[model samples]
Target chain A: MPPDMPTEPIRRRIALTDDGPILVHGPIEVVLTDGKTMISDRAVTALCTCLRSSRYPICDTSHRRRVRNVTARGSGSGMDRGGRGC
Target chain B: MLSSTSPRPVTAPALPAPRGPLSSAVLAALRGISAAPHAAEIPPGAVGQADPYGEDLQLALYCCYELHYRGFAGVSDDLEWDPGLLGLRRQLEQVFLAALGADVAGGTDVAAEIGALLVEPVDAAGVSHHLRHAGQLWQLREYVVQRSLYHLKEADPQAWVIPRLSGPAKVALVSVEHDEYGSGNPDRMHARLFADMMTELGLCAEYGAYLDAAQATALAEVNFMSLCGLHRRLRGGLIGQLVTAELTSSPASDRLVRAMRRLGCGPRAIEFYAEHIEADAVHEQLIRHGVIAPLLAAEPELARDVVFGIQASTLLADRFADLLLSRWAQGRTTLRNPLPELSHRR
Candidate 1:
């Protein structure tokens, strides 16, 4: 394959995302354990190391915390973040 | 609407219908019906009298800002810099800003504001959530029509802040905007993708076609972007608007995707929101660390304005959602002119 063909070494900028996807700046091809390969052409491709994203290998913000604090709530004083009033 | 490259004149859509005196005068000026822009009775000393978010003021301000993006057909390009129009625009902006100033209390806590946006409220039932669960197909169609006004010109508004920014913020903003403009491929541009989605959904995809139907809140949302962009002093507000959009879009977009899927929408229609699902995830990161962080570091004084920007965007968006949900609850059309119900859709 032309991609596998000999070429000069190219530098890659990689950032480790805490409990999230690994940010790699460049076009990348990932070979999965089941022999399936996925290719991304984004300027920066987020490879999901946590494997939590619905769109595998791509961070869908599924890594963000979603704690259900039952005790932290009072008599639901008023509507919070999203607009959900009747 | 413009396909301009370097060293080229641009083209945009024609004028939309005027709701009241404010829009009527501006539209008349654009049509050359009044060569004496100064003579035109367009909110002359009446800016303060107009309701800040009413149909008249919002639509009038929207027309003025449209001159910067895509001037109406047959309108003079030189009109964009007309002093009279700028004077009127300043008046309208002051009225709106005064209202916003009174409404959203100003602060310098950018971190807390963004943190609130990051958390997904479990009790949320915004438009996307409603559409995902119980919204009818016709309601979905209406939502797209209203949204088309902004989506057709996706990244164009924020693009104005480019020259105003410096260092890492500018670089990062441009990088995210690069993706919005379709990463050097006009075919993949978010605007183009949105247009395709509109076509797939059997709606008019042409620029500004839905202007007549868009409500005051919808127009106000776009006007907020233009208001911030045209002024160098309001760059912080523009970034704040951007941060709100990038941070909130991912989850809302995911719900939209689910809505489309539940409604059995075509792949092309789904692609637009699906693209947002992944793209905005990355964009949120870029805005937080790349744009917001660097911008605050470079210019610490902009924090209050940034908060203003965030609150303004949220206020306008909530108002829009309120209009949609309330109207839908009553089984009425949110748009001024209701779309014809297609037999196939029903």
Candidate 2:
């Protein structure tokens, strides 16, 4: 075990593993097979917050829609003000 | 919890200690080699009894009903179809459903009933209200554990009516079901989300873990689900139950979400309620405008049963709420026994 290894890795059975960055959320610590390690906040996605692009889990056009939605809802409001569905 | 391929299909834990003679007979029959032939014998005045919420009778009926859901751990799953047990279950149902029929006044207007359901109770002194205010995490966990009996396989009880329904009603119900089933995304399934919350809260995620400890009120509530679900004739009742649930769920769910966050629970623990806050709000509208509207529009006769379903479900819910709140008022745990003494921090 590496000295800096995460003590508690987020555990979920892999349902699908494609050629894409795996998104981990909520108190996660990832340990790659080659001993690389990473820790994350509760909401972090793999290199992309916007759910866009053909290569999902990676940013594409989806991020733009998300950015606008965030703005429409007002940044940092935490409440989706846009009444898309009531 | 066993996977499909597993050789050992998980069984329900053994019947809890019997509450009365009715439960005793029911449990004995469930555990015995051959069911006692007197399965049809009704406790004197079982039907007309003023307090139809008798723990003994209710628990017995619940046990008989549980066979249809998850059979007890040591009990044979085949008992689910045992004729004697079925006969017993039917008798119990007749008594219980008859009581509900008599008590819940028949409503010719289903729309009025559905509309009435959408109206949230003000100053509703229930678990959700408690949770939204001073409810501690342990209390919330206990409540969820009690709720596990239902949420673990939500939408299943109502699923019985899918085939019974046609046209718009069926499509709308299925639409709601699709979401409940996670829209082909297993990770997003509501039941899965609930289990995740259980795990996050350090409760046993195994289905039915607390069956032995769940009081008769809790058991009766889920048993009502099974009663309405399993009977083809009770499809309207089931839909009524479903409507009541979806309609009332959103605000309660919002309160639960706030409760989880106030207690400083993490995202996984809060996600179940958070998801329901939106999902059930949409489901409420769908059930009202989509399902019930078309359903009663087609078969207007079902309105009576629909009323029965709503009233029966509400009665059971009130009983459950009383059990919990009364227990809490006495500074006691609502479970049959308090969970193993683990001091829950925060």
The root-mean-square deviation over C-alpha atoms between each candidate and the true structure, in angstroms, is: 5.1, 12.9
Report the C-alpha lDDT of model 2 over A1-86, residue by residue, as the tens digit. Answer: 99999899756422111222234333356564578765533232233334433333332212221222222210112121110011
Per-candidate interface DockQ score: 0.20, 0.02
| The 10-residue segment with the lowest total lDDT in model 2 chain A | A77-86
Clashing pairs in 1: none
Task: List ranges where model 2 is wrong by over 4 Å.
Answer: A1-86, B1-12, B33-37, B40-51, B344-346
TM-score quality measure for candidate 2: 0.74
- lDDT tens digits by residue: candidate 2, B85-172: 7776677777777777776656666666654544444434677778778888778877888888777777777777788899999997
Query: Which candidate number has the best lDDT?
Result: 1
The numbered model that scores best in TM-score is 1
lDDT of each: 0.80, 0.66
